[model samples]
Target: MATVLLLRHGRTTANADGTLAGRLPVPLDDVGHDQARAVGERLRRLPLAGVVSSPLRRCRQTLRRALPGAAVTVERRLTECGYGDWEGRSLSELATDPLWQDVQRRPSAVSFPAGEAMAAMAARAVAAIRDWDARITAQHGPGALWLACSHGDVIKAVLADALGLHLDGFQRIVVDPASVSAIRFTPQRPFLLALNDTGGDLRALAPPPGAADSADAPVGGGSGAR
Candidate 1:
C-alpha cells in the first residue's frame, strides 16, 4: 500500500483574521511560521519521498519550512477552492447569507457564485491525491511517505472521498490549519489512518529499520472558511 499525508497549510494572515482567503496569495503570519515549524520538525524524522503543495504562497511557505530537504513540487490541482465573491471576506459578514447555509449543509448542490463547483472541486482533489499516491509509490516504493499540503476545503474533500462520503457530507470532515491526515491507498479502497491529527507522532509511517527504504526515525487551529 502507498500512503499520502494531506496537510492544511499553516495559519495565514487571512486565517488568523477569520477571512475567507479562498485562492488568494495570502502569506503565512508569524504564528503560521511557528505552526509550520512544529509540524515540519515532527515530520522531518520520516523518510519523506517528496512534498507536493498548493501553489498559493501560504502553502508553499508551509511546505518549505516543514520539509526543508525534500523534493517539492507546485501542484495547481491541490489549490484551495475558489470562493469567488466571498474571497477576502469575513465569516461574520457572510454568516446570514443563504448560500453560506447551503454550502455548509448541502455543498454538492451549490456552486460558488462566480467560482468552482463543489462537485468538481472534490473530483479534482481526489484525482490529484490518487495521482500523487501512485506516482510516489512507483518512484519510492509502497511504504512511501509523501505529503500534499493544501487548504481546508480541498483537504476535506479528499478525506470525504477516501471515506466514501458524498460531497454534501464533506463539511463534516474537519481539517484544521497545519493539521495532517493520513490515507493508505490500495486497489480495493482507500483506508484512512488518521484525521485532523495535530500532534506529532507519525513515526509509524516510516519503514521498519533496515527495511531497504532510505529513512531515519519517527515523529491545529480551526478550519478556515476555505
Candidate 2:
C-alpha cells in the first residue's frame, strides 16, 4: 500500500479575513506559521518517502518550514482552485450570490464565474494522486508514506474521491488549514485512513524509522499552483 498524507497549507491574511485567496501569492500569517511548525514537528518523527507541495508561495513556505531539510517537489496538479474573478474577495461578500448556493449544494455542476470547474479540479487532482501513488509504491514499496501538501478545497476533493462520495458532498468535508489527512492505496482497494487529522501524533501510521526511508533519494520538482 502507498499512503498519501494530504497536508493543507497553514492560515494566511486572506484566510483570516474570510477571503478566497484562489491562486494568489498570499503568505502565511503568524498563526499559520505556528501551525506549520507544529504540524512539521509531528511529521518529522516519520521517515517520509517524499514531500510534495503546490508551487504557491504559501504552500511552499509551509512545506519548507514543516519538513525542514526534506526535498520537496512542486506539483501543479495539487493547486488551489483558480477562483479567478473572486480572488481576494470576502466569503461574506459572495454569500449572497446565487452561485454560492450552487457551490455549496451542487458542487458537481459548478463552473466558477471565471475560474476552474469543480469536476475538472477533482479530475486533475485525483489523476495526479494516482500517478504519485504508483510511483511512490514502486520506489518505496507497499506501506510507504508520502506527503502532498496543498490547499483546502484540493485536499477535500481528494478525500471525497477516496471515500467514494459525490463531488457535491465534498462541501460537507471540512479541511482546516494546516490539517493532515491520509488515504492509502492497496492492491485490493483504496483506504481512507484519516480526514482532517489536525492533532498530529501520526506515529501509528509510520512505517518505522529507516523502514523504506528515501531521504537520500531525489524526487522531481517543478512549478506548482497556489
Candidate 3:
C-alpha cells in the first residue's frame, strides 16, 4: 500500500478574482507563495518519498515550496482541465456568453467550443494518478508516501476515480488552495483517508490573499463551483 497526497495549487491572480484559469499558465502571487511555504513546513513532518506536479506554473511553484529539494517529476497528465476559449474568462462573462451557457448546461457533452472534453480530461487525470501509484510501488516498496501537486479540476477527477463518485460529485468535494487530500492504495483498491483538509496552523502559515474563491470561503467552503 502507498499513501498519495493530492495538493491543490496555491492561489493565482485568476483564482483570487473568481476567473476560470482553465489550463492558463498563471504564476502564484505573494500570498500563494506564502501558502506554499506554509504547506511545505507542514509536509516536512511527513515521510514524503517523492513529489509530482502538473506542468502549469502555479502547480509547479506550489510543489517547489511544499517539497523543496525533493525529487520532483512533471506529469502533463496532471494538468488542469482545459477551458478552451474560456481559459481566462470569468463566470460572469461566461454566464452572458451563449457558448459558456452551453458549457454549464451540458459540460460533459460540450467541448470548450474548441477545448478538450471533460471525460477526456478526467480520464487523463486518473491515468496520471494510477501511473504515479504504480511508480511509487515499484520504486519504494509497497508502503510509500508520494505527493502530487495539481489543480481543482484534475484533483477532483482523481478523487472521483478513487472514490467511485460521479463527475457531478466533483462539486461535492472542496479542495482549497494548499489543502491536502490523502489516499491509500492496495493492489486491489484505493482507500480515501482524508479529503480537503486545511487545518494546519495558519498563524505560522496563512493562505495567500485571494488564493481562494469567495464562493467557497470561511475555510471549508463546502464545495461550490469547480
Candidate 4:
C-alpha cells in the first residue's frame, strides 16, 4: 500500500467568520494563500506520486498555490460534507439547534437536517482513499507517496477511521486548515504516521530503499525513522 498525505484546505472567509461553508464554493482568504505556499514549500521536500483534491473551489485554490502546475484529479467523494440546510450558516447560530449537541457528542447518530449523515460522509471518504491508495500502489509501487486535499470534517472522519476510533469520537480529532496528516496502509492494517502536523520535516516519511511494502510493525516500534 502507499502512503497518503491528507491536507485540509487553507482558511476561508467563512472559516474566519465562523460560518459553515459546507458544500459551498467559498474561496480561501489572504491568510489561506500564505499558508498554502508555506505548506507547499514543506511538501517539496518529498516526492509526491500524485495529488487528488475535492471538487471545491477552496481546495482547488489551495492546490494551485501549493503545487502550481501539478495535475490534480478532482474526486467528488472527497467533497465537503453536505450540510444541506445548514450551508452558509454561522456556527454559533447552529450551536443552539438541538442537533448541534448530537453533532458534537454523537456524530454517528446525527444527520444534518436536509443534509448528508456523518457516518455516510465517513464511509465515502474512507472508500475513496482506500481505492486511491490501491491505485497508486499499483501504478507507482508500494513505496509511493501521494496527497489528497480536502475539507476539515472529511479529513477528520478519515483520520478517525485510520485511528480505529468510532465516528462518535471524531470530534476529538482537530484538523486545522492547511495542516497535513499521514497514513500508511499495509496488508494487516493502517498505521497513522502523523496527525494534524502543521510544521515538521516530511522527508523522513519517504521509505528507505529495499523497504518491504507490507512490512509488519516491529515489536518495539523498530528503528525510529531509519
- Among these predictions, the greatest TM-score belongs to 4
* Per-model TM-score on C-alpha atoms: 0.89, 0.90, 0.82, 0.97
Alpha-carbon deviation at 138 in model 3, angstroms: 1.5
Note each model's CA RMSD in angstroms.
7.1, 8.4, 9.5, 1.0
**Span of ten consecutive residues with least summed lDDT in model 4:** 206-215
Q: Could you give candidate 3's per-residue lDDT for residues 1-226 as a string of tens digits?
A: 4568888988888888878888877888888999998888878877677788888999888878777788788998988887788778887877888776554445456566687888788889888888888888688755577789999878877887788887655656788888888776666567666688776532222222332212222366433222
Q: State residue 136's C-alpha deviation in candidate 4, in Å.
A: 0.2
What is candidate 4's CA lDDT for residue 124?
A: 100
For residues 109-214, write the lDDT of model 1, one tens digit per residue: 8788898888888888899999988898898887777889998999999999989998889888888889999887777677677899898588865544333232
| Better-scoring candidate (TM-score), 2 or 4 | 4
Q: Report the candidate with higher TM-score, 1 versus 4.
A: 4
lDDT, candidate 2, residue 35? 93
- Candidate 3 or 1, higher lDDT: 1
Cα deviation at 58, candidate 2, in Å, is 1.0
Each prediction's Cα lDDT score?
Answer: 0.83, 0.84, 0.75, 0.92
Higher-lDDT candidate of 2 and 4: 4
Give the alpha carbon lDDT tens digit for every residue of 1-226 in model 2: 5788999999998999899899999999999999999999989988799888888999998987898878999899998888778788899999988889999999889888789998999999998888998999889887688999999888999899888899989998999989999877655556676789889578766544443333232246412111
Residue pairs with backbone atoms closer than 3 Å in model 2 (clashes): 55-224
Candidate 1 local distance difference test against the native: 0.83
Candidate 1 residues lying further than 4 Å off, grouped into runs, are 207-226
